[model samples]
Target: MGVVINQSIKNTIITYLGFGLGAINTLFLFTRFLSDEYFGLITYILSTANILMPLMAFGVNNTIIKFYSTFRTRQSQNTFLTLILFLPLVIIIPFGTIGYFAFDAISTWIANDNALVKEYVWLIYISAVIFAYFEVFYSWAKVQMQSVFGNFMKEVFHRLATMFLLFLLYLEVITVDELILLIVIMYVIRTCIMMVYAFSVKRPTLKFTKLAKLSDILKYTTLIIVAGSVANIILEIDKFMIGFYNILENVAYYSVAIYIASVVGVPSRAMHQITNPLTAKYLNERDKVSLKELYQKSSLNLFIISGFIYLLIVLNINELYKLIPEQFGSGILVVFLIGLAKLFDNLLGNNNSILFNSDYYRIVLIQGIFLAIISVLLNIYFIPHYGLNGAAYATFISVFLYNIIKVSFVYRKFGILPFSENTLKVSILIFISTMAFYFWDFSFYPIMNIGLKSLIIGLVYGGICYYFNLSEEITKLLNKILKRT
Candidate 1:
């Protein structure tokens, strides 16, 4: 539990730091510097790439994580890891080649009336493969319980690289065509770097042993792909559908809204990086006490922290959107809806980690498939009417219900729920803080003076939480912070 807490802290710091940098890029640079159409194009490419990643990798990343601890010797572990790494190529190489040769035909079919997006469809497809391969390497590191560095590289480095590319495009040092190509190249570079560092951390050998049952591993690997595809569709089908149904500019608006909503889940993503392996380790040891403790505490702590962040975003959303263009400002409701969905996601805490590593993982596939269908149907029904907001609405409803199902499943299987008295207190505190922030006027001063207002609000919020002892875990954390100061 301590190790989980320690790792979660580091992961949270890195995740939020990455998000802070992204907020600047998204709200200021991307929204200000790029047209909404271009912004949508960039987001569409990435969203499309994310959707394709699990298909291309064949889900070996997760299969490796699940089975890594099962290997008895270091040599066997290396051999198993090596197999997972190369096995994807057997499928991806042939598929990628087919894609390359038939790129023009595929691009023509998907190309909408938007001429600019049509011109760049090929680049998006190429970037998708690059992003997929990086996960192949990243998952190898993750199973080793080495996630902070890789998470930093994946979440932070790519954004920083993209920011630099945008600057180059702005300066005319690179043509728009070149900038599109650079996106693919940057992902490829990050993957290469991860591959290099992976060897330094745990040098995997190409040695194959008859002792390692390749057929059994392949069975699990196949399950993971189906599961991964379902999960990806649940998260991303809306974006793809939005692109297909609405104008590229609408996709751009939805992207900004999703970006803002994504911040609510940063803490959850950071925690998942560490928690997955920890859950696996606990499951392997059959340590029910530790598992339940970690599960409950993680739920409470995450809610306390993430709920506060969600409140900040929801309350200050109008002001934050004001930092961008009026077109982006129209995404405020989208942010609120999706933000609430993500907050519901966070409240489940390590429920996902617990379920994913447990025997009932097959249920995840069922639930994911169900949610994916709902997400698609809702988007199709609503997007034509509401445009970008319709997509956001679909995502919010599907994701919120999806999380409830997952939490319920975890409770049914484990006889545990990721909530407690602390959870109730945190919810009340957030409600009060959000109402205060929303009604309190900082309008007397210029918008440039907003930072001071935000700081004051944060201080007051922190003070209330401190005095109330919102969560024992959080109170201890604040004490540690004060001592260090």
Candidate 2:
């Protein structure tokens, strides 16, 4: 817990910094500097690339995390590492060739409804490939139990680079087309830097020697491709489907709402960087006691943290929208629905890490495939009917059901649940705080109102949580900070 708390706190700060920059870029810069259509196009390109990232990496990112700690000898570990490093080429080369040969058909199909998507379709593939290698290298570092630097690179560096690019766009130093192209180059550069950092952590000694579990590792990697793709599809498919079913600008609007809601999940994302490898280590040692403690503690801490974020977003949503453009205001419901989904995701804690690292991963994979299909079907039926709000509903329902299944399976199999008596207490606290602050708005300007309201909410929420000792970890930290002050 010491290392977990230390790194998670640092990673959380880094992640929030990144999200803050992203909010400025998403809410202000893109809205001010770029036309809505191009903004949507940029969102569409990135979301589409994310959907394709799993295939590009061949699931080697997850493969490294799950398998890296299994080998006892350096020789075998090097062999396994070497295999994963090049495994993506097996998929990448063929995928690239296919894209080259079928570029026209692919672009035409993707751009059927919105012709704007066709011209920049190739950027999606290139970005996906870049994202794939970046995750692989990041995982390489995570296996060494050193994630703060990689987390910084993952969460901060790219957003800062994007900020610079946005500034360049503002100055008319680059055309929108060049801005888009440079975004791809930015990703490529980020990946290269991460690769350098990963190697510096532990330089891979490439070896071709066949290992005993080579077949098993390959099988896990192959199955994980589907699993990883399923997760991404659940997250990004809404944006892609919205692009396909409507104009590009709607995607931009929806992206803003999604980004706002995504802030709730930041704690989970920050914590997972360190928890994932730790989960793998626990499972490798068959330490169910430690694993269960990790699971429950993670759930409680994340819920407390994310619950505050959810309250902040939901309570100030109206004021927040007032700060953004009116067209984006229609996504108020999108924020609530998606924000709730993210909140539940935080409650799952290390559920994903446990399932993915354990032998029960195959079951989770199958369930993910089922939910992915359901997600696509829901979007198909909903988005055309209800617009962006409909997409939000689809995502909320899909993620909600998926989390339930994962939680149930973990409990049934391992006899452990992510909740204790304090879980309900946190929920009640969140509800009370929301009801208390949401309607108690000041008559100031939107920015001032938001700042004042948020400050009050944070102090109130922190005070109550600390007083009740809802989370021992959080309470101790708060007390420590207070003592220092």
Candidate 3:
């Protein structure tokens, strides 16, 4: 728990810092400096790359975490590690070849609605390949239980690079086209840095020795490719479909809303880094008690923290939008819906880790594939009819159903649920806070208004949670902080 909390705290800070830079870039700089079409094009390119990442990496990131601990012998571990290192080539080589041979067809299909996307189609492939290797290396580090630096690279490094590029664009030192190209270059550089750090932590030994359970490892990796792809598809498909069905600018507007909403998930993202490996360790040892405790504690803490973010975003969304361009203001509902969905995601806690690391991962993979299909169908049916809001609806519905399924599956399989009596109390607190703060506002500049309102909400919400002892872990931490102060 100490390790989890320590790393989670550091990871939370790093992730938020990255998100802070992203907010500045997405809301202030990109909106102000770049034209809407180009902004959306950038968003589309990155989203497409994200969608393609799992395929290119061939699920090696997840495969490493799940199997790394299972190998007992050093020789076996070396062989397993070596296998994952080169596994990605299986998909990357073929995908690159296809992209090279069928570039025109691929570009034409992707640029159906937004012709601007054609020029940047290749960047998506390049960035996805970079993103894939970055994850592969990051997972290499994670299996060693050293995730803070990897988390920083994942959350902070590239965003800072993007911030620098955006500033360059603002300074008129780089064209928007150059800014986009440089962003791809930044991803490649980020991957290189992560590779170096991963090796520093645990240098891989190339071994061609036959690994025990090689068949199971290969099977997991193959299934996880679909599982990983399903997760990314559910996340980024809305943006991709938006580009396919509408103009690129719509993708820009949606990106801002999604970014604003995604801040709620930072805690979950941060906690997952350490918890994932721990969850894998516990499952490998068949330590169901420790696993259940982790599941509940993680869920409770994440809900408590993410609940506040959801309130802050939902309550101050109108004012937050005021700071952005008016064209993006239309995404207020997008923010709310997606924010709610992310809050639900946080409530699932280490459920993802539990599922992915467990033997029943194949079942969850199938569920994910079903949900991914539903996400696509919903987007296809809704985006054309409702525009940006339609995309939000599709995402909200898919994620909501997906989380419910995960939570239920975990409970059914493990006889442990992430919820407790305090879960109900925390839910009530969040609802009350929303009602209390949603309509409360001051007449001031949007930035000041946001700051002041967020402060008040934090005070009130934190006070109630602490007073009621909704979360013992958070309460203890808060008391420790107060004493230190």
Candidate 4:
């Protein structure tokens, strides 16, 4: 738990710093510098690549984490690492070839409604390949319990690079198309740097000698492809579908709202980087007591922290929107809906880690496939009528229902819940705070209003939590911070 908290804090700070850079790009630069169509085109391209990344990687990223702890001996671990490293080539080579032979058909299908997307379809392929290997290497480091630097690479490096690229575009030193291409190059560079770091953490000895449960590893990886795809579709398919059903400009507008809402999820995203490998370690060791404690602590702490973020985003959202262009600001409802969904996601704690790392993943994968189907249907029905707001509706509803199913499954199977007494208390505090401060606003510019409101909310929320000593872990962390100060 100490390691979890320590790394989680570091990872969370790094993730937010990355997101801060991204906010500048999303809220100001992209909205101001790039035409909406191009903005949308970029969003559409990346979303498509995300949805394809799972298929291309063939789940090697997850397989590495799940099986790494099971191999007790050094030789077996080396063989395991070497084996998983090349497994994705099985999927990547074939997928790339298919894309090459059927480029026109593939491009046309992806560019269904937005013709501007056809030219960039190849970029999607390249980006997906980069995205796939990046994960493989990141997970490569995760099994070693060295995630902060990798998390930085994952969350911050690319955004910082993009910010630089966006500025170059603003200065007319580069065209928008060139900016997009440079972004892909940046991904390639990021992945290479991560590869170097991961190798330094635990140098991989190329061992071809395989004398272990290779079949089990292959089976898990095969199934995890669907698992990864389902997760990606639920999160990203909205943007992809919006590209198909609407114009490219709508994608940009929706992207901005999604970016704002995604901030609330920073804690969970950071925590998961560490919790995932830890959960896998516990499950592999059959340490139920430790596992359950991790589940509950992870849930409560994540809820308290992310719930504050949810308040900050939802409460100041109006003022925040005032800073952005009005066209992009239309997704106020989108921000709230998806922002709440993100908070709900945090409430699940390490539920995803438990499910994905456990043997029961097959059942959960089937459930995920079903939920993914529902997400697609919801988007299809809603996007035509509601546009960006409709996409948000689909995301919120799907995520809400999906979290319920996952939480229920974990309880029914493991008989452990992620919630604790503090869970309800945190829920109450968030509700009361929302009610208390939501209608309260400052009469000032957007930046000033946002800052003042955030300060009040943070003080009120943090002060109460610290005074009450809400969770022992959180209180301890606060004490440490105070002493250091």
Candidate 5:
């Protein structure tokens, strides 16, 4: 338990360091340094690549994590590893071939009026290939509990490359077209780095072992592909639909808002990296005690952490948006909606990991498919009428309901719930803190004014948390820091 907690904490700190860099690059530098149209184009291209990745990878990444524990010997694991490593190419080839044939039509449809977008659509496709394969390689590291390297490479390295590209663009060393080209090249480099790290962690032998269960592996991979696509649609279709119904500038606003919302989920991501493999191994052994403990603790910890971050963001949102361009200030509603959705997601914690790795995972596929349908319908009905705000509303409602359904399903099947008196107390504390922080206005100068107010609010909030013992771990850490100071 100590090691698990420590490793999770370390991974989370590292992740946030990366996220801090990314937040600056995405929200501040990108908007300040580039035109909104160009920023929108960048986000839209990444979103498109995200939408395509699950299909291109054929869900082999997920299959790797779920099945890797079943092979007992190192040799068997290596063989199984090799199978997933190269298997996606079999499907990717056909998909890429089909994409090549219809490239112009699809490109025309997605970017109907934007010449810049049409020119860069193929770059995004090339990016999707790299992104998909790198994920497969990263999953190989994840199942072995080697997440820090992959997480660093993923959360840090990619953004660093983008930052350099932004600098190049700012200096006029790269034209808009060159910047777009560099984006594709960065993905290629990032993917290659991850592949190198994957082999360094555990070398996948090329020795062809006669495995009779190829059909079973393929079937599982196919099912997960359906499941993965459904999940991806729920997460991304809102952004795509927003771009479709509105314009690139709308996407720029929505993307910044989503970036704000995504910070709250960082804990969930860090915890999942550690817990997912554990859950898979535990479920295989039917270790209900440890599994249940992991689920509950994960939920409680994430809720506490996410609650703090959410409160901070909501309270300081007015000030934070002031740091960006005036056009982006309209994204406040989008931020609140998406932030609430992310909070709901964080509260579920390892519920996703437990379910996805369990024998009852097919239920996940069913729920995901249902959520995908709901998300698409909501986007269709709302985006035309409400624009980006409508997209946010649709996302909030769909994701909120999707998580609720998953929680209910897990409870019915496992008789485990991820809530307690402490959770309720934290919720109440969050509400009170947010309300108090909202009404108090402070005006100083520039962005430093925002930073100062945030510091004061955070200190007061920390005092309240410590006084009430909202989280023993947090309280203890704060006490230690205070004492040292």
Candidate 6:
């Protein structure tokens, strides 16, 4: 628990710092320096690549975390690592070959509505390969009980690199093409660094000995590809579909709105870093007592934290949009819709961790494939009609439904719920806080207004949670902070 708290706080800080840099790049730099078409093209390229990442990864990342603790001997661990390390190529080689042979048709299909993306089809493949291995190595390190460095590499390094490239673009030192190209190179370098760090943490000998559970592992890895894709598709398919249906700039608009709303997910991102491996451990050990406690506390903490973030984003969305360019301002409704969906996501706590790690992953994963199909259909119908808002509508509905399925499944199988009396308490507090603080603002510039309003909101929110002891862990941490001050 101490390790979870310590690393979660660090990861939270790092993740927020990265998000801050991303905000600058997305809201100010990209909109100011890059044309909406180019921004949308870049977003489309990355989102498409991300959708392919799970397939390229072949689910090695999740497999590593889930299975690593079960292997007791060094030899077996080495055997396990060796298998997963090369498992991705099973998909990558054939997939890449087909992509090469049929690049024209595939790129044409993806770039159907937006031709600007055709030339960048190769970049999408390269980026997906890079993204896959990065997660593979990140997981390698995670099973070593070391995640901070990888978290920094995951969250901060790439964005900071992109920020530098954006500045170079601003200075006329690089063309947009060069900036995009350099960004791919930046990710390659980031992944290589993570690979090195992973080995530094645990350079398990690469042995080719047959793993004891090769059949089970390969089966899980293959199934998890669809499962992982279910998540990525839910997250990024909106942008991919937007690019498919409309011109590229709509993706930029949708990307901006979703990016703002994504801030609401930062706490979950932070805590999941440590909690995931821990949850895997508990599940592997079949420690229901520990699992239940973690499930609820993580939910409570993330709900409390994300609920506050949700309020900030939804309440201040109008003022927040004032700083961005006018053309990109069409996503205010997009932000609101997606913001609520992300709040629902946080409310699930460790639901994702538990489900993915449990024996029932197979059934839930199959269900996820259906939901992925549903998401695509929703996007197909909505994006053509409502444009950016249409995409948001599809995403909000898909994510909300997906979360609902995951929670219900976890409860029905495990007979445990993530919610508690405090969850209801936090829900009420969030509702009251939103109504009280919203529809009112300081008479100041957008930044000043956001900061002042957020400060008051934070103090009030934190004060209420602390005073009521809604979360003993959080309350204790707050007590420590108060004592230090």
Candidate 2 per-residue lDDT, tens place, 1-485, comes to 99999999999999999999999999989988999999999999999999999999999899899888889899999998898899999999998999999999999998874667888999999999999999999999999988999988888898999999999999989999999999999999999999999999999899999886888888889999999999999999999999987578899999999999999999999999999999999998999999999999999999999999999899889999898789989899999999999999999999999999998989899999999999999999999899999999999999999999999999999999999999999999998887787788899998998889889899988888898899999988988998999
Per-residue lDDT, model 5, residue 403, is 89
lDDT of 3 by residue, 129-187 (tens): 99999999999999998999999999898888888888898899999988988989988
Clash pairs detected, candidate 4: none
Q: lDDT of all predictions, in order shown?
A: 0.79, 0.93, 0.93, 0.92, 0.83, 0.92
Q: Clashing residue pairs, candidate 1?
A: none
Task: List ranges where model 3 is wrong by over 4 Å.
Answer: none
lDDT of 6 by residue, 1-485 (tens): 88989999999999999999999989999999999999999999999999999999999999999999999999999999998799999999999999999999988888894567888889999999999999999999998889899999998999999999999999999999999999999999999999999999998698997689888888889899989999999999999988887578898998999999999999999999999999999999999999999999999999999999999898788789999898888999998899889899899998999999889999999889999999999999999989999999999999988998999999999999999999999999999988998899988999899999989999999899999999998999988988999
State the local distance difference test value for candidate 4: 0.92
- lDDT per residue (tens digit) for residues 318-400 in model 5: 87887788998888998899898888898887887777777677778888888889999999998888888889989998888
Regions of candidate 5 where Cα sits further than 4 Å from its true position: 212-216, 472-485
Ranking by lDDT: 2, 3, 6, 4, 5, 1
Which of 5 and 6 is the better model by lDDT?
6
List TM-scores for all candidates, in order.
Answer: 0.95, 0.99, 0.99, 0.99, 0.95, 0.99
What candidate 1 gets wrong by more than 4 Å, as runs, is 211-213, 444-449
Model 5 residue 354 distance off true place after TM-score fit, in angstroms:
1.1
The sequence of per-residue lDDT tens digits that candidate 1 reaches over residues 1-485 is: 66667877888888888887787777777776677777777778888778878877888877777778888887888788778877887667887788789977777666655567678787765776677678878888888778888888878897888888888878879876677678778888999999888777888788776647778688767767777777777788787887876477878787778888899999899888878888877887888888888888778777877887887777767666666778776788888888888888889888877876677887687778878888889989989988878888888888888888888898888888888887887788888888777766566443643566667777887887889887777788899999999
TM-score of 3: 0.99
